[model samples]
Target: MGEMYTTHEEEKLIDIVLDSILSGVVIIDNKDHVIVDVNETAAKMIGLAKEDIIGNVCHKYICPAEIGQCPVFHPWQNIDRSECVLLNYKGESIPILKTVKKIKKDDHLYLIESFIDISKIKETKEELLVKEKAIDSSINAIALADLEGNLTYVNHSFLELWGYGDEKEVLGKPSVEFWQDESKAEEVKNALFFEGSWVGELLARKKDDTDFLVNLSANMASNEFGKPVCMMASFVDITDIKKANLLIKRKLEIEETVASISSMFISPKNIDQTINVALEKICELCGCSRSYIFRFSNDGTRMSNTHEYCPEGVSPQKGNLQDLPVEMFPWWMGKLHNGEAIHIKDVSSLTEEASAEKEILEMQGIRSLIVLPLYTNSELTGYLGLDNVLNTGEWEEEDINILSLASQITGAGLERRNAEDMLMNAKIAAEDANLAKTEFIANMNHELRTPLNSIIGFSDVLSSENFGTLNDTQKKYLSNVVVNGQHLLRIINDLLDLSKIEAGKMELFPEKFVILDAINGIKATMMPLAKKKDIDLKCNINIGNPLIVADALKFKQILYNLVSNAIKFTDQGGSVTIGVNTSNELISVFVEDTGLGIAQNDQGKLFNPFSQVDSSNSREYDGTGLGLALVKNYVEMHGGKVWVESEVGKGSKFTFTIPVENQITRA
Candidate 1:
C-alpha cells in the first residue's frame, strides 16, 4: 500500500508540474466529448476549474458556441479544422487561443487540445495604430520607403505636401519619381546605402508638374542582422527661406558698394579727379548708365559741361541756363539755382514741362535720375547728375544723404581749385610788373647819360682854355656850358635816387636842421637859372625858424628838384616863388610856377616814370620828366604827401608836407 501511495504521489507531482507550463493543455476520454484531464493553464483559459473541465465535454468548455450547436462535436460532419476565437464562459465570450486534434491511445480515440493567450498581440496592434495617427498629424511631411527605394508608406502631410490624395497613389511608386532632376536619384541612393542618412535640399515635383525646393533628411532603417529594411524621410518647405536669402545677399552687395564709394574721399588729390571718381563709383553702385557734372556761369546765362561719363555711342544734350526753354525745363533751373537736389524716379509721371525734359532723357535711355546741386559759400556753383539706374527703383534716404555729402566734398574741392588759380594769376601779374620796371630803368639810364656826357666834355674843354683864348662872348658861352652840365648831372642823380626808391632800396639820411636853411639852399641853387630867364624866384617863410629832424640830403634834393622843375617849365618872363610854412607837427613847402598848366585828362599819369603831361609837352621841356616824379617819391619816403593844384591856362602850385621829429633822425 505504501508503494501504491508513492506511485500516486509521483503522478500527482507530475500533474502539478505539467499544470504550471505556459501552454494550455487538456485531455479528453475515448468518447472524444468529455475532458478527462486538464492542466491549470487550460482550465484558466476556458474560465473553468480543473475538476469541472475533467468531467465536461471539451466542446462545451472550449468551442466558440454551446455544445449542442458546436460543429466540431460530430466527427463525420466534416469540420474543416481548428480555429481561434473567444470561448463562451458564464454567458460571456472570453478570448482564447485554441487548437484541437484527435489522439489514439491503446486503440481508443482521445482528443488533445493546446492554445496560447494572444491578447497582448491585439493590444500591440492598437498601439501601432496610435503611432501611425501621430505621424499623420505632424506638420512636416513624413515618408517611408522599402530597402529597394520603393515608396511603402506616407503620412497625410507627405501626400498633401506632394499634392497627392492618398498613400495608394504613391505606395508602389519609386521615390526617385518625386525628384525633379533624375541625376539626383543616384546620389540619393548612394547616400542611403553608404552613409545610412542624407540631409540636404532638393527640387521636388508636385502633382501639377510644378517644382519647389525642399530641405530633406532621409535615414535608413535596418534589422538586427544589418540588412536595410526601410527608409524614413522628413522634409520642410524652404522656398520662402531661399527668396529671403537672395534679398539679403543683394542688400549686402549694395552696402559694400556704398562703403567702397565713401572711402574714396579720405584724401582726394584734386577736384576734377575726385568728381570723376565719384561719378564712376556712383554709376557702379546704383547701376546707372550715365553721369554728368554741369557748372553754371557766374551770370547764370549758361551751363558748361565740365565732365560726362556714358557709353561709347551715347551723348547728352548741351543745355544753357537762360535759354532752357520753359517748355523743356521749368523747374529744373529754379531748383538748381535755389541749391536744391532733385530726384526723378519715373520720368513718365512728371508734369508737361518736366515730361518734355523726361522725353529727351528717355531718348538717351534714362528712366530715373538724381540731380545734386554743388554750392560754395551759399551760392550755386554746379550740379552732379546721375541717370538711368538699371532698376528704376526709388532712392532711399540714406542714398540721398550720401549724395549730399559727396556734393559738399565736391564744392570744397572746387573752391580750393579756384583759390589756387587766383593765387597763380597774382604771381604772374607781379612778375610782369617787375619786368616792365626793369626795362624802364635800362631806357632811362641811356637817355640821361648821353646828354650829360656831351655837356661835361664841352664844359671841360672851355674851362681849360683848350678851344682858344676866349673873348667876352666866348667866356659867357663857356659859363653857360658849365651851368647846364651841372644841372644835367643833378637831374641824373635824381633819376638814380628815384629808381632806388621805386625798387624799395632807397635809404634816408636824417639830421637836425632849420626849415629856413633848406629853403635858402634851394633859392641859392636856382637863382642863376631864374636870372637867365629873367624869372623872379623868391622864398617866403611864413613861420619862425623851427628846427626839425630829417634827412638833410634827401630834403635838399627834394627842394632842389621841385624848384628846378618850376623854373624850367616857366616861361622866360614868368615868376617862380618858393614858400615854407610850419605847423604843429608838419612842415609844408610850396613851389608856384607860372607855366603851361597840366590838362585834367593828363593829371592821373603825372607821377609815372618818363611820363610828361603828354608826348607834345615832352618836346617843349628841356628838363628830364623824372624830376617831379622823383620829388613825389622822396616826399612819400619821408612820410609826406606831394600834390599839385592847377588849371589848364592858370599857374600851378605844387605843395608837399613832411612830418617833424624833435629827436635825432638816422641815415
Candidate 2:
C-alpha cells in the first residue's frame, strides 16, 4: 500500500511539472489512443473539459476525421517523430508548431507532444512588413550608412534623390560620389566621427551630370554599448534658394547704378555730355564693355554716332550719318521712327538674317545689347545703346529695365538743353534787331524831314491863297500842288508809326466798345474809295452788339487798312464785304474782296515791314508798303491773330480774332 501511494505521488509531481511548462502538452497511449491527461493550457487549446478528454481516443477527440489529423497519434507507427495540426471541439483548426516523441515504460507506449501557437509570430511579421512599406513611401531622402561610411540601406526617396535605379546599384557605392567637390567628403567623414552629427549645405551631382545644392542633416547612430553602428541622413533640395539670392544681389547692384546715373542731371550742361556720363555708368554697373549714343537727323534716315565709349583699345570710330547700312539695322531704324525701345538678349541665337550684324559685334566680344530711342517733345532725337561685350550669356530682363531708365533720364536732359539753346538764340536775335532799329530811326529822321518841311510850308501858302489871285487854270494847278504835298506828309507820318511798332515802343490804349460799331465806322470811311472804283462796299455784322476790350482808335485803324487795301485791289464793278462774328469768348472779323488776288508765293512776304507782294503791286498801290505791317502789329498788341487765305485768282479773305470784354473780365 505504501508503494502504491509513492506511485500516485510521483504521477502527481510529473503532472505539476508538465502543467507548469509554458508550452501546451498532451499524452497518448498505444494503438493511437488517449489516456487523456491534458494540462490546463492544452485543455483550453482544444476547447475541451479535462474530464471529457480524459478517456477519449486521441485520434477521435483531437484529430477527428474530416479535420486536420494529429501526427502525434501515430508517432511510432510512422517515422517515430512528427508534427501536425489539432482541431478544437468547434472543428476549427489551430496551427501549432508541434514536436512529437515516443516514450516506452514497462511495455506501455506513450506519446509526448509539445507545441506553441504561431498566430502571434505571424502577427509580428506582418507588423514589421507594414513599417518597412511606410519607410519606402516617404518623400524625404532617408538613408542608413555603416560606421565605415558604406551605405547599408536606402529608402525609395533616397534612391530617387540621388537618381539611382535601385539599392543593388547604390548600396556599396561611396556616399562621396553625390558631392560635387571631392574634398567635402573628408570634411563630412570627420564631422560624423568627431561630433556624431553634421547638418549643412552640400553640392550634389545628379544622374544627368548636372549639380545642385541640398540642405542635409546627418547623425551618427550607436548601439547601447556606445559602439558606433550606423548613421542616418535626411536631405532637402535648396538649389532654387541659392539662385534667388544671387538674382537679388544683382538687382540691388543695378539699382545703385541707376541712382548714380540719375545724379548727373543736377549739373548737366550739354546733351552729349549728359548721354556720355549715363552710358558710362550703365557700362560700369552691368559689366558691359561697349556703349554708343547716336543722334538721328531731322529726316530719320540718317544716324550719326554722337558719342561712343569702350574699354581700352576697343573704341569704334565716330561713324558718318549716312554710312550705317539701313538693312543691317532694321530694328534701330524702326525705333528711330516709331520711338520704341529694342532689347536683344542673345545676338547669336537670332535667325541668320536678323543676326547678320552679329559678326561685327562678336568680333568686339559683344553678346547682348539694348537700344533705347530718345525723343524731344515726340520728335525722334537720338538713341542710347548699351552692349554686354564680356558676358557669356544673354542679358536678363532686369538688366534691360535698368538701362532703359537711364536712357529716359538722358532723353529728358537733352530736351532741356535744346530748349535752353533756343532761348539763348532768341535773346541774341532780339538785341541785334533793337540795335538795327535805333540806327534806322536816326537815318530816317535826318533823310526825310528836310524835304517834308519845304512841302508843308508851300502847301500852307497855297491853301491860304497868300501868294496872289489866280486864273481858273492857275488855280487848278495850285490845287494839284497842295493835294500832292498833303499826300507826301501823310506818307512820312505812316513810316514813323511803323518804326515805333517795329521797335516794340508802341503803346495800346484799351477801352470797352461795341465791336460791330467799330466795323461799321471803318466801312463808312472806305465807301467813297469803293464808290470811285464803282465797287459795292458792304458790312455784314453777324455778331450782335458784344463789347470788346481794345484800343478803339487802333482797332479802327486796323480795320481801315484792311478795307482800303481791299478796295484798292478790287477792279471796277467788284465788291468788298466786311463781316464780324462774335461768340462767348472770341470776336472774329472777316474782310472779303473780289479783286486781283495775291499770289500764293507772295503771301508770306506781305507782312514784313517795307515789303510788298511784288514790285508791280507796289507800283500800282502808290504808297509805302507798311500799312498791313502796322495792321498786324496793332491786332497782335490786343492779343489777337490775323491770317490771310487767298488764291491767285479766287480773291482773298482776311480773318482776325479778338478776345471779347467778357472773356477777359477777370483781367
Tell me the whole-model lDDT of each prediction, alpha carbons only. 0.75, 0.74
lDDT of 1 by residue, 467-556 (tens): 678788878888888878787777667666766776777887777888787778778978998999999988787885478778888788
Per-prediction TM-score to the true structure, in the order listed = 0.42, 0.49
TM-score, cand. 2 vs. native: 0.49
- How many clashing residue pairs, candidate 2? 0
Q: Which stretches of candidate 1 lie over 4 Å from their true place?
A: 1-127, 146-150, 164-174, 185-187, 190-195, 255-285, 290-328, 331-667
**For model 2, where is the 10-residue window of minimal lDDT?**
73-82
Candidate 1 to truth, TM? 0.42
- What candidate 2 gets wrong by more than 4 Å, as runs, is 1-276, 279-283, 286-430, 442-454, 468-504, 514-521, 541-548, 581-586, 598-612, 615-625, 643-650, 662-667
RMSD of 2: 12.8
Q: What does the lDDT read for residue 497 in candidate 2?
A: 77
Tens digits of per-residue lDDT for model 2, 18-90: 7898877877665546644678778888887877777777765453433234444334243322345577788
